[model samples]
Target: MSSDLWSFALNVYARPGVEDACLRLQTAGANVCLLLCGLWLEQRAVTCDEQRVSLLRTLTEPWDAEVVQPLRTLRMQWKTRAVDDAVLKGMREQIKSHELEAERALLSRLEGVAQAWARNAAGSTTWLEELAGAAASPNRDALQVLRVAATGT
Candidate 1:
């Protein structure tokens, strides 16, 4: 598996069931980028703590709200109408690609911050769960799928 967040996210997300799981979690209000970041940090043995979790949230929430969400909303809004209009469909595809690029940028930014955190051999990380917060219970199975796929266990 790749070590960088973007590459690791691509590799893990390509695993069977991971895409569905991530979508499910995303629908449940979890930030998919943060979830991927959590998985990356956990694999590196970075300790999970309230401060660290808060920092990740602080970095992610605004970017997601201001950038990714708007692109997603526009893409989704075009779904039905785009089907019947060729031009709309082309624009929708472009928006979808832009959304992906925005997410990749988020992951890169996350990696930059996370790389400074030292990994501890004895540390236990629950980044996925913590980041998922309230959504963790409802999307437990989906979250587990991510964990399994991320760790290849």
Candidate 2:
């Protein structure tokens, strides 16, 4: 009944206060990428299957969660449907607010990552190249596309 690495890590890193928890966890040998991904999932309510989890296994070791129930609530809220105009309008506003918050959080994180890489990239040609790639990563591009589509202007 063991889960894959992502599930295990998500189980651990998505807990309340885990972002601040990472300083101690890093001292104990946790992967920063997993820490970041866990935070992202917490903020976005993204989930993965076992296969996807397995793919990330090698990049980081597994961890467990203490509080993921809130995520389930958010997921259920996301699944809810609006039946009438008032309900639909309220739902739409709520969804827009959620999306804006998520997008702002993601972009802020990505900007920090990109900036860190840019700042320390001196003389490390390979690292700089990799950093540049990360700056334009597919996930960021996809997010930009989503934002543009959502705004329609």
Best by TM-score: 1
lDDT tens string, model 2, 3-115?
Answer: 23233334444444444444444344433444344333322333333443344433223211212223323544655464345666576667666643543343344433323
Looking at model 1, report the run of 10 residues with the lowest lDDT sum. 119-128
What are the root-mean-square deviations of the candidates from the true structure over C-alphas?
Answer: 1.2, 16.3
Candidate 1 wrong stretches, greater than 4 Å: none
Clashing pairs in 1: none
TM-score of each: 0.96, 0.27
